[model samples]
Structure formats: C-alpha cells, structure tokens
Target: MRAAIAGSDAVRGTTSPNPPVGCVILDAEGNQVGLGATQPPGGSHAEVMALVDAGTKARGGTAVVTLEPCAHHGRTPPCTRALIAAGVKKVVFAVADPNPAAAGGRTVLTDAGVTVESGLLADEVELGPLRAWLHYARTGRPHVTWKYAATLDGRVAAADGTSRWISSEESRAQVHDLRRRIDAIVAGRGTILADDSALTARSADGTADGTSVDRQPLRVVVGTGDLPEGARVLDDAAETLHLRTREPSEVLAALGERGVVDVLLEGGPTLAGAFVQAGAVDRVLAYVAPTLLGDGPVALGASGVSTITGAHRFRVEGVTMCGPDVRISAVPDRN
Candidate 1:
C-alpha cells in the first residue's frame, strides 16, 4: 500500500481534477510483477498500466491498488474488466469510488469470485491520491487549494506592498507545474491589479488557450473594483472570467456547474480569509521563507481572536521543504 501511494507523487501537477492512483501487482511468490499509475483524465488507468506490465504474469496474482478499480467505462474501459481479464485472483485497496457509476468495483469482483480486502492505510492513501476528487465529491465544486508565499513570521509582503522572491526559483517552477493540473487559477481584484498576473495556465510548451484544451482554466478575478487598463488578464478580454461576488459559495457554485473540478486560489488576503472563514478552503499550501517581515501583510487576513485562546482550528496535513523555504499544508477538521 505504501509503495502504491508513494507512486502518486510522481505525477501530482499533471493529474488535477482527476485523483492520482497507483497500483502494484504481485505474483504468488510476493515478487512484484507489474506497477502503474493513473496518467491523466482520459489516458491509461493505473490498473491497465500495471496489468500491461504484469502481462501474462498477472494470472492468479494479487493486485494491490490505492483506490478501488473504477467500475464504469468513461475515458477508458472499466478497470474491473482489465483485472479480471488479467486473471488477478485477489484485490486489496484503500478507498472506494464515491462516483455513482464507479461505486461497485468490489461488489463486481466479489460476485466474480475474487477475494477483496479494503482500508489498509486508507487515510494516507486517500490524501496522496484521492484528495481533489474527495473534496469535489463532498462540496460539488473544485477542490480549492490556497497557495501563497510568506515570511517565517507569516508576512506575505512588506507594509509598502513590495513582495518579491519569498521563495526560490525551484519553488516557483513547482508552482507553475501546479498551474497546469487545475481547471482554473483565481485571484482577487487586488492581486490582478497589483500583480497584473496573466492568470493563464502556462506549461513548458506554451499557454492554455482557454478553449480547445480544457478551456485554459477560465482565467478568473473576483471583484466589484476596476482593474487597470493595461493588465495582462484584461488585455485578453475574451479570455478572462470576472466574477463580482461578495460571497464565496455563490461564485464557487457557478464555477462548479461549468465542470471546473479544481481551483488554485492565488489571491489576496481578504479573499483567502473569506474562503477560509466560510469553510470553503479545502487545502492550504503556504511557502514560508526563512526571514521575518514583521508588520507586513500577515500570511492570512487579520482577525481579532484576543489571544491564542480564541481561534478557528485546522489540522496540519503535510510539510516539505522547497529550496530554502518550507511548504506547509493544512485541512479543516471535518468533525
């Protein structure tokens, strides 16, 4: 299970909206026969790749996959059919499909006389692979992961608003890769005006056209305020999606209806806080640098809690170092 889940990290930035899954097939002697991962939305599925690698060796073997085999056909054939054809005799998994069409993989396998066991390291497996999908299934909108850069003391910028290079080049490249996976990237009016961010989903080859290929994530800005005339997002008039909403749920719901399944919020403090306070934030990814900027914009919007005694709590999900900075992620307690 650990190996299956670990394989998901290799394709994080490209899998957006789609949950990343990993699979491993082992023969009777417990020697690995095949290994694979979910490619993209409509590409080869994890089990197909693993079965392909396993080939004829898959017969009578055990297949351990991080997520349940998908039961229905969509971009690819149903994975249950692949496993059965490959002759995998037993299956073990960490999660079940919540999608209506995919809800009965284990049932189908059981009816076919295959043994199945589930929930081995389920939480960790889900976090690594099914995070975006689970978040979307629960809220009916794209999973929103608010990404930001801040000082060690949690300042996003100085009092003068001269924020630059909070993290290293390596980290910025990593962020861009994140840009490619999601259906859209959003910013507040302030970020759009101040940064003049293109808000386009850029990749190594070129920028998304917002039409042909996933519609370029619908470049979005939230505001009632006006943006500068020369801003890049404004320059491409037909390409931008502007939402004038004071409420988070209203805007998110509209986006969800359009098939947007994941959103990366690279917006300003007020907007980020609005999302968090509204219980709209699904994940928080912050890059904390080593220096302290003191009285600048804090990592989050200012709220009066009167001390540590008064606070809204969230759980730390994971932490990793990017160049000289540390990235911290958290999820709200569903309990």
Candidate 2:
C-alpha cells in the first residue's frame, strides 16, 4: 500500500477532478509483480495499467490500490469489471470512492468471489495526494488554500503600500511549486490593479519548466471592479476568468462546476478577509519574515471578529524554515 501511495503522488498535478490513484500487483506467493499510477484525465486507470503490466502474473494474484476500484463507467470501463476479468484473487484498498456513481466497488469484487480488504493505510492515502479530490467530493466545493507572506508583526505591506519581497526568494519559489499543483489561482481586482501579477506557475526567473507543467492553472480575478485592458493576468499564457463577484462561496461554486478540485487564493487583504469571514478558507499557508513593519497593512482585513473569543483558530500542521523566512501550514480548527 505504501508503494501504491507513492505511485499516486507521482502524477498528482496532472489528474484534476480525478483522484490520482496507485496500484500494485502481487503474485500468489505475495511477491510484488507490477506497479502503476493513474494517467492524465481520459487515460487508463491505475488498476488497468497495473494489470497490463502484470499480464499473466495477475491471474490469482492480490491487488493493492490506494483508492477503491471505480465501479461505474465514464470515460472508461468499470475498474471492477477489469479486475474481475483479470482473475485477481483479492483486493486491498486505502480509501473508499466518495462519488455516488462510482461507489460499491467492494461489493462488486466481493460478489465476484474476490476477497476485499479496505482501510489499509487509509488516512495517509486520503490526507496526502488525494486530499484535494476527496475534499471536493465530500463538500461539493473546491478546497481553498490561502497563501500569503507577511512581516514579523503581521504586516503584508509597508504603510505607503510598497510591499515588495517581504519573504525570501526561496519562499516565493515554493509558492510557484504550489501553483503548479492546484487547478486554479485566484485573486481580487484590487490585486490585479495593484500588482498586475501574471499568476502563472513559473520560477522567479520567469520561465515555465515545460517538462513538469504541461498547462498552467486557470487565472481568476474576483470583484466588481473593471480590469485594465492590459492586465498581466489577461496574458495568453493561460485562460483567465473574471468572476465579477466578491462572494467566496459563489466563486467556489462556479469553479467546482467547472471541475476545479483545488484553488490557490492569492487575493489581497480585503478579499482574504471576505473568504475568512465567510468560512470559505480550508487551509492556510503563511510565510512569516523576520522583519517588523510597525505601521502597515495587515495580512488580512477585518474578519468581523471583534473579540478574542470569536477569533478564528487554526491547528498547525507543519513549520519549516525557507531561507530566512518561516513557512507555517495550518488548517481551520473547527472544534
């Protein structure tokens, strides 16, 4: 199962709207025979690929997969059918299929005389590479990860609004790597007017590594303000969407319908405040610099929490040092 999870991680960015699944095949003697991962959208599923790699060795063998074999047919045939026809003796899976149309794979396999075992390293599989798609399937909304950089005193910009390079170059590079994984990158019209950021997933030197990124994420601008004709986000590097709304739920719902599983929110303070106040933010990626700006704009605008009792709490998931800056990752504490 661990090997299966590793296979899932290898193709994370390319399989949006579909979980990046992994599979490993073992012969009757329990020796690993083949390994496979989900291909890009409309390509072969992980199980089929593994079966093909195993060939005759797949008959009477056990299959270990990160996600349950898909039971329904969409762009391809049902994975359960494939496994049954391949004469697999048993199946072990990590996570259950959350889609209603694709559920019940376990029943299908069990009824076909194949032993089925579930929840093997399930937490690791669900929270690791499949986190975004599982969240989207359960909530019917894209998982939003709000990312920002601020000073030691929590200032995003200086008092004069000249916010340039608050965090180190290393932290900025990490953001580009993150941008390559998500389905869309969103900002407000205010940010577009102020920074005119290109928002493409590129290195600090402004070059896209074609080998890793076949397509750039969708660039999105939200708000009622009109954008200039030559906004950098409107460049032909990638398709751009102007939502013309300030509500976070509306933006997420629209993106969800478009098959967007994850969203990277690069919006400004006011827009970030709206998402926070609306409880739309699922995760937070904050980079804290060592410098202090006593009087300047904070990282987020008013979130309507007047007192400490009403404060939004987050549980720290990780803390790391990126050059001279500290990168903190957290998720909302809903307890």
Candidate 3:
C-alpha cells in the first residue's frame, strides 16, 4: 500500500478529472510482479497499466491499489472489468472511490468471486495524494492551497518593498516541485506587475538559467488591471490565462471549467486577503525564514476580520525544516 501511495504521488500532476491511482500486483506466491500509476487523461487507468505489466503473472495474484478500482465506463472501460479479465483473485485498496459513478468496485469484484478488502492505509492515501481530488469530488470546485513565504515577523517584504529570496534554497526548490504537481499557479495582477515572475516550474538545477521543466502548471493571473505586454508570465514557458476578475470564486470557477483539480495561490497579500475574506482558501503552506523584519508588508492584507473572534484560525497539520527555513502546512479550522 505504501508503494502504491508513492506511485500515486509520482503522477499527481498528470491526471485530472480522473483520479491518479496507483496499483501493484503480487503473484500467487506473494512476490511483487508489477507496479503502475495512472496515465494522463483519456489514457488507461492504473490497474490496466499494472495488469499489462503483470501479464500472465496476474493470474491468481493479489492487487494492492491506492484507490478502489473504478467500476464505471468513462474515458475508458471500467477498471473492475479489466481486473476481472486479468484473473486477479484478491484486491486490497486503500481508499474507496468517492465518485458516485466510480463507486461500488468492491461489490463488482466480490460478485466476480474476487476477494475484496478496503481501508488499508485509507487515511494516509486520503490525506496524501488523494487530498485535492477528494475535495474536488465532494465539492464542485478546485482545491486551493495558499502558498507564501515570509520572515519570522510575518513580513513578506522588506521596508523598501524588496522581497527577493526570503525562503532558503531548499524551500524554494520544494515550492518549484510543488508547482509541478498541481494543475495551476494562481496570482493576482498586482503580483505580476510588482514581481514580474514567470511563474513557471523550472528544473531544480536550472533555476539560475530559467530552464523550465517538461511539465509546467497553468499560470493564471486574476484581476481587472491590464498586464504589461512584456510581463514574464506572457512568455512561452507555460500556458497563461488572464482572468480579468478579482473574485476568488470566479477565478476558481474558471479554472474548474478548465478541469483544474488543484491550485497553488501565489498571489500577494491583497489577493490572499481577498480569498481569505471570501472563505475560499482550503489549505495554507507557509515558509517562514528564521530572520525577522520588524517593518514590512505582512503576509496578509485586510481580510475583513474586524474582531479577534472573527479571526480565521487554522490547524497546523505539519511542520518541517527546509534547510534554514521552517515549512508549515495547515488547513482552515471551521470549528
């Protein structure tokens, strides 16, 4: 199951609308035979790929998958049918398929006399690779992760408005890797005007030369202001979209229409505050440097929290050291 989860994580950015599932096949003697992850859209699912890899070895074998094998026919045939045809005898899955159309795979397998078991490392799978997709399935919107880097005093920029290189090199590399795994990178027009950021996910070693990776997430700029013709985001590094709207929900809706499942909000403090005020932020990824800047722009602008009771609180999910910086992951605390 852990291997399956890792496989799922490996292909997170490629599959959208379709869950990025992972599967491993073990022969009758319990020796691992094959492993695979979901392909891009309109491609074979994870089980089919793994079965193809297993070939004749799949007969009477056990299949361990990150997500329940989908049982419905969408872009391709149902995965349950493929598993049955592969002659797999037992299936162990971490998380059940949440889509109404994709659910009931266990039943299908059981009806075919295949042993089916679920909830093996379910929480890990759900909270790890499946987190954004599950949220998109339950809600008809993209999952938003607001990302920001600031000093220990919560200052995103210095007093002179210079905000370059706040986080350590390791943290920046992690951010670039994260940018490669999501559907889109969202920022406001103000950020584009001020930073002139390319917003492209570049190779870890090519950051100095500005060489982008093979797969770059969609760059989305939101706001009514006009972007300069020479803006770096307008280059050919990746696809760029000008939303021409300041509403966070509207931006998300537009991206959702484009089949975006995960979003990294990289906008400035004002834009971040707007999303916060609209209650649209789903997760928060903060990178805090050890240094402190007493006078500078904070991480967030006016967020409509007039009273202390109205503060938007969040539960810290994790804290880790990224070189000299501290990285924190948190989600909103609605309770």
Candidate 4:
C-alpha cells in the first residue's frame, strides 16, 4: 500500500480532475510483479497500466491500489472490467471513490468473485496524494492553496517595495517542486507587473536562468489588465491564461472547466485577501524568514475582517524549517 501511495504521488501534476491513482500487482505466490501510476487525462488508469505490465502474470494475482478501481466508463473503459478480465484474484484499496459515477467498484468486483478489502492506509493516502482531488470532488471546485513568503514581522517586502530573496534558497527550491506537483499556478496582474515572474516550474539549478522543467503547471494570470509586451509568462515555456476578472470564484470556475483540480495561489497580498474574503482558499503555505521588515506590506490585506471576532482563523497543520526559513502549512478552521 505504501508503494502504491508513493506511485500515486510520483504522478501528481499530470492527472487533474481525475484522481492520480497507483496500483501494484502481486502474483499467486505473493511476489511483486508490476507497478504503475495514473497517466494523463483520457489515458489508461493505474490498474490498466499495471495489468498491462503484469501481462499473463496478472492471472490469479492480487492487486493493491491507492484508489477504488473506477466502475464507470468516461474517457476509457471501466477499470472493474479490466481487473475482471485480467483475472485478478483479490483487490486491496486505500481510499474509496467519492464520485457517485465512479463508485461501487468493490461491489462489482466482489460480485465477480474477487476478494475486496478497503481502508488499508486510508489516512496516509487521503492526507498525501489524494488531499486536493478529494476536496475538489466533494466541493465541485478547485482546491486552492495560498502560498506566500514574508519576514518575521509579517512584511512581504521592504519599505521601498524592492522585494527579493525573502526566503532561503531551500525554500525557493521547495516551492518550485510544489509548483511542479499542482495543476495550476495563479498570480494577479499586480504581481506580474511588479515581479514579471515567469511562473514556470524550473529545475533547482536552473532557477537563475528561468529554464523550465519538462512538466510545468499552467500559468494563470488573474484580473482585467493588459500584460506588458514580451512578458516572460507569454513565452513558450508552458501554457498561459489571462483571466479578465478579479473575482476569485470566476477564476476558479474557468480553471475548473479546464480540468484543474488543484491551484496554487501565489498572487500578491491584495489578490490573496480577495480569495480569503471570498472563502475560496482551502489551504495556506507560508514561508517566514527570520529577518524583520516592519515597514512594508503584510502577507495578507483587507480580508473582510473588521474586528478580532471576524478574523479568518486557520489551524496549523505542520511547521518545518527550510534552511533559514520556517515553513508553515495550515487550513481554514471552518469547524
């Protein structure tokens, strides 16, 4: 199950809207035969790929999968049919499919005389690779993670607005890795005009030259404004979309239409505040440096909170150190 979960995490950014599932096949003697992860949209799912890898060895074998094998047909045939045809004897899955159209895989497999077991390492799979997709499936919207970097005093930049290198090199590299694992990276017009960031996921060593990695997330610019000519974001590094609106919900709706299940919100404070005020941000990833800059803009702005009681509260999920910076992960305390 852990191997299956790792396989699912390996292909996070490629599969959006569809859950990035993982599967492993063990022969009748309980020896590992094959392993595979979900491919891109409209492609074969994890189980089919693993079955293909196993070939004749899949007969009378057990299949370990991260998600319940999909029962309904969409872009491809039902995974349950593939498993039955493959002659898989037993199925062990970590998480159940929440989408009604894709549920009931266990029942179908059981009726076919295949042993089915679920909830093996369910918590690990849910909190790791399946977190964003599950949230999207339950809410019918893209899951938003608002990421920012600031000083100890809560300032994003110095007094003169010349902001650069607020976090350590380790933190920046970690953010690049995170960008590569999400569906889209969203920034506001203000951020583009101020920083002219390419928003492309780059190799850690290539960060200085703006060289993009092979698989880059979609670059989404929000707000109704004309981008400057020859902007780096307009280059052929990755796909770019300029959304002509400042409404957070509108932006999310458009991205959702494009099959974006997870979104990384890297916009400026105003844009972040807008999303927070709209209750659109689902997670928060903040990097705080040790230095103090008391005279610049804070990490967030005007989030519709006029009093202490109205404050947008969040529960800290984790705190870790990245070089000299402190990384904090949290989610809204809607409870």
lDDT of each: 0.78, 0.91, 0.91, 0.92
Worst 10-residue lDDT window for candidate 4 reads 204-213
Per-residue lDDT tens digits for candidate 2, residues 1-335, read: 99999999887767878888999999988989989988888998999999998998989999999999999998989999999999999999999999999999999999999999999999999878898899998999999999999999999989998877888889988888888878899999999898888889988556776675667889999998788999888889899999989999999989998889889998799999999999999999999999998998888988889999999899998899999999999999988
Q: Name the TM-score of candidate 3.
A: 0.97
| TM-score per model over all chains | 0.81, 0.94, 0.97, 0.97
Query: Which regions of candidate 2 are displaced past 4 Å?
Result: 206-212
RMSD of each: 4.4, 1.7, 1.4, 1.5
Candidate order by TM-score, decreasing, is: 3, 4, 2, 1
Cα TM-score of candidate 2 = 0.94
- Residue 167 lDDT in candidate 1: 74
Report the candidate with higher TM-score, 2 versus 4: 4
The C-alpha local distance difference test score for the whole of candidate 1 amounts to 0.78
Q: For each predicted model, how many residue pairs clash, with residues at least 3 apart or on different chains?
A: 3, 0, 0, 0
After the best TM-score superposition of candidate 2, give how far the Cα of residue 326 lies from its true spot, in angstroms. Answer: 1.7
